[model samples]
Target: MRNIKMTIEYDGSRYLGWQKLGDSDKTIQGKIENILSEMTKTTSDIIGSGRTDAGTHARGQIANFKTTSNMELIAMRDHLNTYLPRDIVVKKLEEVPERFHARYNATGKQYSYYVWNTPVPSAFERTYSYHHPEQLDVTKMNEACKILTGTHDFIGFSSLKKTKKSTVRTIKEITIHKEGDLLHFTFIGDGFLYKMIRIIMGTLLEIGIGKMSPEHIDTLFESGIRSDAGMTVPAQGLFLDEVFY
Candidate 1:
């Protein structure tokens, strides 16, 4: 058997997110696994670096599967692209060491969120950006970003109800920058909890609008109160930008 590492890019507009669900066939993992199983004549379970919420997009999502087939990497990639939906594409594939588990081997990940800051909503970007008409103070948002960076227990910012797993994760960087009518928020982290990035983005937006102060971030860290953090922003604005090993 050979371990195949693959990089995938997807629009994610119509899929039910990355994980394969028992009740649904409209998932990224399900689609790829179905194609691979049919091609290889055996069950092919692919492991993703992490799961993206439904309606979210990905530019560099990494995954891998072990297969008994001896098909060439290029041919396998071409075959996957041809059979999978147009929204999902296999960007690259290569053989990796046997122990290279996609999820467990991942060291870090980068996620990006986009906001339409202008008064007029964008027709083309409607599915890709969150539309916020209110004027945002970019400088104030950056101040909040500074507070968000570094290591901390981020339970308050995630949608996870409860888990024994550690919610404490290191956020290496958080940056908010404006490009014309758009506000781009980038987050690099060792790991993130469910809906953590969206919740953090919502908090930053609240800070930008003067609805919350940057100092309030400290309170959330100390209190770990989910209700005190911020709203869970819509999933469409979020993107899995990259995965690092």
Candidate 2:
């Protein structure tokens, strides 16, 4: 068997999420697996770097699977693209060593959140960005971003009720930039817990609106309580930008 690695990009608006669900077949993973299974004439199980929430898009999601097919990597990629939905595309494909894994071998990841901060609705970008009509204090938001960086216990930001695995993760950096009526946020980290990015963005939005103080982030970190943080923002604005191995 050969271990095949592929980088993928998808518009997640119509799908349930990246993971295959028992209740629904409208999933990113399920679609790709179905095509792959049909091509290889075998049950193809794929391993993704991680799952993105519903309506959360991806620019460079990574996955790998073991296959016994003799098909070349480029041919397999082209064949899969022909059969898969137009919103989903395989960006790159290659063979790797037998031990390489998509999830277990990942070292870091980066995600970006897009926000449309204007009163007049954007006709074209509405579906891709979170629309916030209120004026946001960008300086305050940047302060909150700085406070959220570095290693810390992010249990307060995560939606998981409980987990045996460690909630502490190292955030390499957080950046906020603005262009026109749009605000963008980028987060680089070793890993993130469930809903952590969305929750953090919500907290930053509240801080931007003066509803929460920047120091509130400090309190949340110290308390480690989920309710102490801001609301979990909608998934549409979040994107899995890149996964590093």
Candidate 3:
């Protein structure tokens, strides 16, 4: 058997996230597995690096699966692309060591949230970016970002109410950049909980709009209270930038 690693990109506007659910649902993993099973004539499971929520896009998502077929890498890539949907594409495929597990071996992940901070509605970017009519103070947002750097208990940013374990995670970097009317918030982290990035973005946005003080950001780390965090931004604005091993 050989393990194949695939780098995938998808526009999540039409699908129900990355994982496969029931037969009634259409998912990114389900689509890939359907095509692979047909090509190999066997049961195949495609494991993803991480699960993106519905309507969340991916630019460099990674996945791996074991196969017994003796097909060449080029042929397998062509075969899968012929069967996969247009919204989802496999950018590259390669054989990897059997010991490499996509999810468990992932060292870190990078995500970006985009916002069109303007009054004009963008016809092309509406689906991919969030539109904010109010002007945001980018400087204040950057100041609040400092509070998010380093390791901290992030229970305040997570939405999982029933989670009993600690939400401690390390954020390696948080960058806020603006060019023209577009604003991008990039986060690099060892791991993240449900809706953590969106919540962090929301909190920073509040600071940008002068609704929340930058000094208040430290309360999230000290208290670990969900109420101390900001609202959860829409998932449509978030993108899984890449997964690194």
Candidate 4:
């Protein structure tokens, strides 16, 4: 048997999400599993590094699958691309140690959100970014990002009400960059709770538009109230950029 690690990239515009859904055949995981199952002639359970919400994209999503077949990595990758939808592709494939687990062994991840900060509509960026026609103060957004970059119990920033897992997670850093009418927000973290990144982005956006003050970030931290944080931004603008081990 061999343990194979694969990196994937997908548009995620038409798919339901990364996880396999009993409700739909248009899922990233389901598409890949079907191809792998045929190639191995056995059950092929692929473990993803993490899950992305519906309509969310991934540039370097990672997964690992254990297979008894002796298929070469290059042939397997080419075969997967041939059968899978054009929107999804296998970027890299290789053999890894047996002990490597995609989800459990992941040490950190980087998520990015894109915003089209212009009054003019962009046909090209309609599906890839959030279009905000109103003016935004980029400086204020960075101020809010600075306050959010640290270890904290982020229950206030998540959509989940209850869980046995800890909501306390460390955000190693956050970097915001703007060029012309485009804004990019990058987050590097140990881990994120459910909908945590979207919530944070929404709050920062409110700050950028003068709807919320930067000081409100501290209030949310102290209060731990989900409603007090911000809205849950659309999943379309979010991307799982990279996963680190």
- Across 1-245, the per-residue lDDT of candidate 2 in tens digits comes to 99999999999999999999974778999999999999999999999999999999999999999999999889999999999999999999988999999999999999999999999989877777899999999999988888899999999999887788899999999998897888989999999999999999999999999999998999999999998888898898899999999
Instruction: Order the candidates by lDDT, highest first.
Output: 2, 1, 4, 3
Clashing pairs in model 2?
none
Query: What lDDT tens digits, residue by residue, belong to model 4 across residues 76-135?
Result: 999999999999999999899999999999999999999998899899988989888888
TM-score of 1: 0.98
Q: Residue-wise lDDT of candidate 3 within 42-148, one digit each (tens)?
A: 99998899899889999999999999999999999988888898889999999999988899999999999999899997888898888888999988888888878
Which residue segments of model 2 deviate by more than 4 Å? none
**Candidate achieving higher TM-score, 2 or 3:** 2
Q: Can you give the lDDT of residue 172 in candidate 2?
A: 93
TM-score versus the correct structure, for each prediction? 0.98, 0.97, 0.97, 0.98
Local lDDT at 187 for model 2: 96
Model 2 accuracy (lDDT, Cα): 0.93
Q: Please report, in order, the local distance difference test score of every candidate based on alpha carbons.
A: 0.93, 0.93, 0.89, 0.92
